[model samples]
Target: MVSIAIIGRPNVGKSTLFNRLVGKRLALVDDQPGVTRDRRPGEGRLMDLSFEIVDTAGLENAHSESLSGRMREQTEEAIRIADLSLFMVDVKSGITPEDQDFAEVARRAGGKIVLVANKAEARDSDIGYLDAYALGLGDPVAISAEHGEGMGDLRDALVEALGIEVFDRDAVASDEAIVDVPVPEDDDTPLPYDETKPLRMAIVGRPNAGKSTLVNRMLGEERMLTGPEAGITRDSISVEWEWRGRHFKIFDTAGLRRKARVQEKLEKLSVADALRALKFAEVVVIVLDVTIPFERQDLTIVDLIAREGRAPVIAFNKWDIAEDRQELAKELREKTERLLPQVRGIRTVMISGETGEGLDRLMKAVVDTHRTWNSRVTTAKLNQWLERTIAHHPPPAVSGRRVTIKFMTQVKTRPPTFMLSTTRPEAIGASYSRYIINGLRDSFDLKGVPIRLGLRKPRNPYAAKKKRSS
Candidate 1:
């Protein structure tokens, strides 16, 4: 792993030592000086030295077509693809001239640098920690990174500049081997899908809806920091893809604007880091902007990804600069089935994140809405589709008595939750729970996701002997 990066210049806490070596407050730490303009990455650790850290942007010598020169070309492409850099500086602000011109641009972009010297718990940070040995890139490490103090001499200057056999960890845990698998104590079984796991997803929408230009057109690089700026992303980055062989991770967030124009505080920490990447997404694409597609803040971000149950996928993007493209894709698919009928058949597509057209039908509608949000049915096919959906229409007469529904099951699947067993779970209404969630999404093809039913009742075993004989 050994990646590193962190570098220097603006508000030198370098995202508070990159949220203290990735224990995650994942970037966007405002004391504002170019509140971090991009380059993120994570997975770090220190005591035992795990690696890959990143968190860049604040280097600025600006002017090559502004926006602080595309944030100093994303911190000089994270110090030419890191293998250790750190650099930092602000020893209570002493070593300036933009820290000797980004320490001679991280010593002409060659790697292994270190030299931290952060706020070293400021007692006038000892003449900027002895004026950081005149920007020569060596003996500094003196940190504080916001009071987590010298972090064991910045993990002994990154184990004396990347040695300790590049963090062995028992030869990488004996080159991986752990296979347990045996859990079907029958809750209607069905879990097995692991195509080598990964798929977390998350893109999201609203401001400048090309969600970081469709994540730089699905990582064909420039990784993320597009412009013509709307909210130039403010952090929720993630990124480790792979498609035709599965594995994902995605999460490019921050654009969601409405809560009264998100009255600052860095746009409310970039809309709480885009609702914590739409609640740790399991699938959520949204995107939109094909000339203002479904605005009302894009159906309130598709009803907040159907109240955070996730599995979404809508896309649209700039459809190569639209204009009656097949009658605006048939009036945006009849306004996405009349404004997203709670994700009914929701899987839109039509793209052009700056011309990579329909990104393979938006990742095949996000791997078929994450395989129907991890579907699972069989509790005897959910009681034979709840007895032909209650013989085509039952569960009605409430006070006059007919509300039965004695059982149903599937109590879980990423968005496939179920549970009925009713006699009168308060006469289950909301139009008979949308007719048993539209007959379990038309008898289990489960359409684009968000299902969850819930009810309950069947308890009266003589009501505890009629409450102890009244």
Candidate 2:
């Protein structure tokens, strides 16, 4: 497949164009320049043309050891590997010396380059668009990636540059057909493990918790920019990998800080992006610093995951340098149980993101937690267990009338929601509900995932007759 790299200096709307081509808001966009620091890849399509597209950081003039310099290296690498390069320029701002320098850099890379003049919708952008020709990269493809303008011309330019024969028309048609298939709404059965689908997992935690380092270790390369700086990652970056023949799409998200401390607009955007990743993820790995495990913010994050109905696996990171390993482990386990009784018996793995220690255990725990999250109990087994549980310690009476839960059925999985028909739904107190939930957890081996139990009163058949008689 043909791969295209989108590269430019800061605030050129490169990410906007990349998102437009990929047809998803996969990259973070902001008025702030240099918001993107890593190279992000996605499958892109324009009309019938399909190719792999890479969004790169803005080219900056910095020393090789600086962060901006590192970002430039990533962009250069993307240009080196891609079949083509989309050298984007901000037409509204006109061409600058930086643009001239980066144009030379792209040309030196020896790849087929397409100059894209973005933000062409602005009335004053005409001069800037004209100025793009001075860079000597051929006639620029004028486009407004933000407003979806001049896309047809861009497609024609790509075909002219790369040749139409490069794209697989049949494969693209098949993919479109597959996407048109509708999903069944009534299919509530537990989903069987399908090896063809990639498991979606998100690694999240407070700032500076080694989330990026952990992802780099897993990928066996420096795929993410990492250092002692807090909040190095601004976007929730997803990477595709295969572990033991199982496909996985791992998302490494930005660090989350306390709500009060998040005063910046960019930080809020990053936090919101991280939250979206958590919601869509099948399993979330909460990376906690081992030395100070289970802080208030950490607990809040875990609670948020539970409330979002996401399966969670706890990872105590930075274990390589810790002292008193056994004692620390014991204390952490106790804290996990006492502080997080909602997700009782949650799986916790001690890992070292820097050294690749305990990674297998963490992945296994994630898989197991996801399975448990999707698990369902048969109606017969659920009622039988309910009978035995109530027999042991029945529900307390309300207003001198016993509260009887007659039937129970699992409504859905993916957090495992259940419905219970009871004589009085509102009479069930918090303590009694906790009892039943704990019983269900222990009997069904449903641990580490949130279980939702809803109570409702059965409809009365004689309600109309009683009203008429009265």
Candidate 3:
């Protein structure tokens, strides 16, 4: 539903309206004019209507400045993509010559326009509303963005223009997925894997980290290329092996750089291949050199695991040449705490992928993290925790009314996502959100995996409980 664009001359609350609609501060807004430089896209939901929203830079007279030319191009592209336009005007200042020029340009696009007179809070809006009628776009809606007034008129305008019907989220409390995490039922023993079906594993790290030798050691034969130079293994090559009674498939991938410095041809293609393999994997093992483990690029890879919502276990390989294993291990924990803060409590195991030392711990950690990633909490316990949490702090009241958060549950679990239907999602502080996540980690032992808390509109104005099916 991403067909709406907020366009104006300058500083008429276009960015403010974007932030309010997006429910997140994605675009920067300032008192200064022309703060937005290009078209920015974001996800927004107006009640039940979830759609894409584009906030664009203020239009200006055709000029030769490099930045202006780029902005104009971006603005034109937004107009072409838009299904409907929200033509904004400053009610306080009325229409200027620049506004008239911009109106003509917007009309040339030949899309439906809904005039919006912003800053209509304290003062009258008849002058700006009257001027907008002359533009021949249609009837204009007056709004006060700061006070959140006249949103119903805007909603009605959108409904009439977009031909959309208003709807509400279903309030059914889902109970089916709480069925215990599935294990090998009846056949506790993992039967022998079919010859054609290979158990795959992907080993990824920074450059010159001995990824090639590790694969050679595991295979006991030089099936893949080994070199001292960085990026010798450009393609994701898979190798099959049998460990104990379990079969295995390992994918060796090219290293990822610091994102900005990734300007090479072969490296980019190689990285893209690795990302695809990661997406297809059931388990992902991120290998890092002991000397410089979890660098910014390494964190980027680890964060990619959480972003992709995969089960991850980190292996600090090449431990044979390390100065002191004890001290290095302590330093690694500190670095994980300081740097990769999002996925806290991730299992960090030390291993020599070359010499096969500590490989047992690496395998065990992967199985453990996978189980936790598929975890789900029971309704009784979840409600109990929610009760205790709300009793302790209580959702902070706004405008002299204390809001209530009645029910909650784990909606889905790849990385364990939860949803809390509340009176106002905006009032939940970041610290409190972290508190709930930390409590779940500590109480439920859900360590080292990402936990997502999604806030949704309350079902009833009185009590907005949360639940889900999938």
lDDT of each: 0.81, 0.89, 0.72
Backbone clash count, each prediction separately: 0, 0, 7
The residue pairs that clash in candidate 3, if any, are 2-52, 199-249, 200-249, 201-249, 201-251, 345-448, 346-448
Question: Per-residue error at 408 for model 1, in Å?
Answer: 11
* Candidate 2, superposed: residue stretches over 4 Å from native: 170-197, 464-470
Model 2, global lDDT = 0.89
Residues 1-470, candidate 3: write the lDDT tens digits.
44688887878888788877777554556676766654655665565565667888777776634445545655766787888889898877888888888889899999878899888874666777688777767787998866677888887888798777432223322212123244322323323324343345677778777776677677675545555556655556555677656687677766767768878654666677677767766567888888887677888888888787777778888888888778888998898878877778889888886688877888778767767876777656777988888888776677887776767777666677777878778887788788888878888888988888888775554333333322
**Model 2, 171-239: lDDT tens per residue?**
343112011122232444555765566688999999999999999999998889888888989888889
Please give the distance, in angstroms, between residue 405's alpha carbon in candidate 3 and its true position after superposition.
1.2
The candidate with the higher lDDT, 2 or 3, is 2
Residue-level lDDT for 211 in candidate 1: 84
Number of the candidate with higher TM-score, 2 or 3: 2
lDDT of 1 by residue, 231-264 (tens): 8888888888897887788888888878987887
Q: Who wins the lDDT comparison? A: 2
